[model samples]
Target: MGTTQLESVPEPKYWHLKTVLSEALDSEFSVGEILPNERELAARFGVARATLRQALEQLELEGRLQRRRGVGTTVAPPRMGVAVGTEQRVWPGVGEDAWQAVGCTLAAPPAAVAAALETPREQSVHIVRRSRVSHGQPVAAELLYVPQTSAPELSAIDASSEAARARVVLRELHRLELQGQDSAVELGSARADDARQLDRLPGAPVLVVTTRYFAEGRTAALSVATYRADTCRLTFGASGVEILHGQERQAS
Candidate 1:
């Protein structure tokens, strides 16, 4: 008879450490409470510093912890739920949108954005930069692209200043009758500019949202917003109830 061999299951050290630290956070830590320094924690857990840090990074990504450059890590508050889908189709900045425009400029968008907008590769478009703040912390950064043909009424006077150009482009966009809108969300890493706006390190985990605005039977504009995955829960549709993180799970 031939001997049979069983495969062994391998579990990563960092994953196990992440679970232990997560449970500790739930039972023993309070929001805004600082954790022990990395070296001390690693020693206490009998794990390498790099292993401990990997666990910490996972906790931060789940919004269970917050880490700053110079300051030590602390327990994070519950993730804020931002509404992504609403019943009415309205232009961005038209209603009670949370985004605040920072600046605008004329530049050629990325290839993906150009393809979405159906604009020529060499054509310059209006790029509006915006940021979102939640609970006094920056949570997201957005780049809104408007093709020149969509906002023909914008004059050279508005182009003199960044803020002026942003307003002008939005005003012209509102003139069009919004037919529909569609959006998709995916995981991504923050780029340099987006990282600066989100107050995170480069390559930090992010939730990238791509939205396309339709008008006059054509694509009018495209918006790409990157939300801090560590501190945000992108919610769709309406729900009266809110879910609190780090709280004990109810019996199922």
Candidate 2:
């Protein structure tokens, strides 16, 4: 790294340093390369250690750097592309292999989800938990809400375990004639549960994709998937496959 003293600018010093560090990452660093320690970097940039720390945090938030446990800060790989929506609309878990069923339970969903599902706020629904992994790293977590009215045939004898219940809920969803689906994406902070599933800190940046499945002329199910922002990039397209970090690959 060069000892390029930054000139005074209107932006905060840490912000300016973050921009410079980002450029250095692009030109001088490779993915997974550990950056110099705080003392060395602060001296190199002629900035206070506090300023350097702030800049590093910013870079990490922007998905440019990663601070591994017991390993120093390193350049993060390009975000893996996660297919949020494709032309062929299918129910969650139908023809999908990327996500694994975690568990399922009956509970009252959040108010927003209840509103979206057009269910009574006090009504309990089947909440299915799922996780998605890429490159052997957890990348996303999901909660699929199914109203009782939507899966009237689910029985306790058929779904003996939590995972089994999740599968049965999905099976019931598949029985519905999937009329159409719509999705919306936005930046969000990871909640405690999602952070644990994705192996990220609470309040870490995340991309939230909310999808609504329409069937029988009503909102039958709702899916809210939270993806790790630092490791996943979302894509929407006609082809079922989505681009990987920097290359085209089949969605898994």
Give the best candidate by lDDT: 2
Q: TM-score of the candidate numbered 2?
A: 0.88
The residue-by-residue lDDT of candidate 1 on 157-217, one tens digit each, is 3366677678788888999999999989998988999988888888878899899999989
Q: What RMSD, rounded to one decimal, does every model reach?
A: 6.8, 2.6
Q: Which digits, one per residue and each the tens of the lDDT, describe model 2 over residues 96-158?
A: 466889999999999999999988899899999998777688888899999988899763426
Clashes of 1: 0
What lDDT score is found at residue 219 in candidate 2?
93
Worst 10 residues of 1 by lDDT: 1-10
Q: Which pairs in model 1 have colliding backbones?
A: none
Tell me each candidate's TM-score. Answer: 0.86, 0.88
- Full-model lDDT, candidate 2: 0.85
